[model samples]
Target: MTDQTIIWLVLGAISGSFINGLTGTGTALFALGFYLVALPPLQAVAIVALMSVLAGLQGLWVVRAAIRSNLPRLARFLLPALIGVPLGVGLLASIDAGTLRLAIATLLIVHGVYFGFRTTLPRFRARTPIIDGVIGFIGGLFGGAASVSGAIPSLWLSLRPWPKAKVRAVLQPFNVVVLAMTVGLLFFQGAYNERAIHALLITIPIGFVSAQAGIFVFRRIGDTTFRRLLIGLSLLMGIGIALQELF
Candidate 1:
């Protein structure tokens, strides 16, 4: 990789790692913004998937105790997600790269605005297994396309009545399994070759340090402030990329 490319990927990797460490999710949202600037859309997607598997493993370790208790809840989310992922991957493989990037950039802009502005979201009183499974399927589709499976679940869980710890516990394992599958799918699609391996090797150690630092800051900072800043940056970058591609 060129020095400039390496620098951009490292920045994105560290930032995404930190976000994942803090929220147990949101890594793809932040990382894709930077990766899209430095790499091709599908390459960025592949890199985020690979790193997310590592990050998700770390997250699950931190919440290992809570995973057992959330099994039923997680199963409800996981099954439909698995069913949907291959379908989404099929779509991704068939779509034009420019169209895929446009789709990804649009999601980033919309989701960033939504996450940044919503101080509190209402809990759904009518949540059922069917609804949960559907959300998982949608999340899986997003994951297959962009390594962003956590977005739907994170938003849905945030509004649930579950405690914050339970939410994090569920999110960690949920994202882990989905992201692992995404990596495998992308690999079969030939996204994981020498370049992908090289990128991962260069970024892993730095990502580890950044993730730890994010966990520390998560405990110290005001969540609202940190979220607004990060998501705001994502929103701006998404816009820039979309405009560049269009023009």
Candidate 2:
């Protein structure tokens, strides 16, 4: 790889690590930014998915308390996530990546904007297997297409009457499966050539180091505060991405 490309990969890994740690979206900011700066679409998706798995496994270490405390809830989310992940990956293969990116950007932008206001959407309250399957299916599609699929499921799980620990645990299994499904698809697509694989090699290790820093930092802040920060950042990034088509 050229020096410039290597730089992008390193930067991508760092930026991706920060986003997942801070926002829990796999690669909304970094992966989207790389593509905005003109990386090939297929490559962009692959890098985000690969680094996501690495960073996620890293974060998994820190979140074990959250994971272990909510065994039943984790079970509730896992089966559906696995079922949805493959369907989501299949959609990734069929749709136009650019179009999917634009659509996801638009969805995030709209949600961010609405969140900025006092307006709130109703939360999902269903506990049936069908509901989980449906949410996971749609979430998987969006996750594979745009790396931001967990938001809806997160919200849906939140509406349940469970303790917050169990509610948050709902995301772990889903994200793990999403990352795995994406990696599998990218492998079949031959997205792991020398350069992309090299990028993975360099960034994933650093990503783990950074994740520890993220945990310490997150401890100093409250979720309410972090939620506002994410919304604001996403608003600006959304406008920037949407306008990118103009340039």
Query: Which structure among the candidates has the greatest TM-score?
Result: 1
By summed lDDT, the worst window of 10 consecutive residues in model 2 runs over: 158-167
Q: Each candidate's TM vs. the true structure?
A: 0.78, 0.76
Q: Which regions of candidate 1 fall more than 4 Å away from where they truly are?
A: 37-40, 93-121, 125-127, 219-247
Q: Report the number of backbone clashes for model 1.
A: 0
Off by over 4 Å in 2: 26-28, 35-39, 92-103, 119-133, 145-147, 154-168, 229-247
Return model 1's CA RMSD, one decimal.
Answer: 3.9
Q: What is the lDDT of residue 92 in candidate 1?
A: 70
lDDT of 2 by residue, 97-118 (tens): 5676576567657866776564
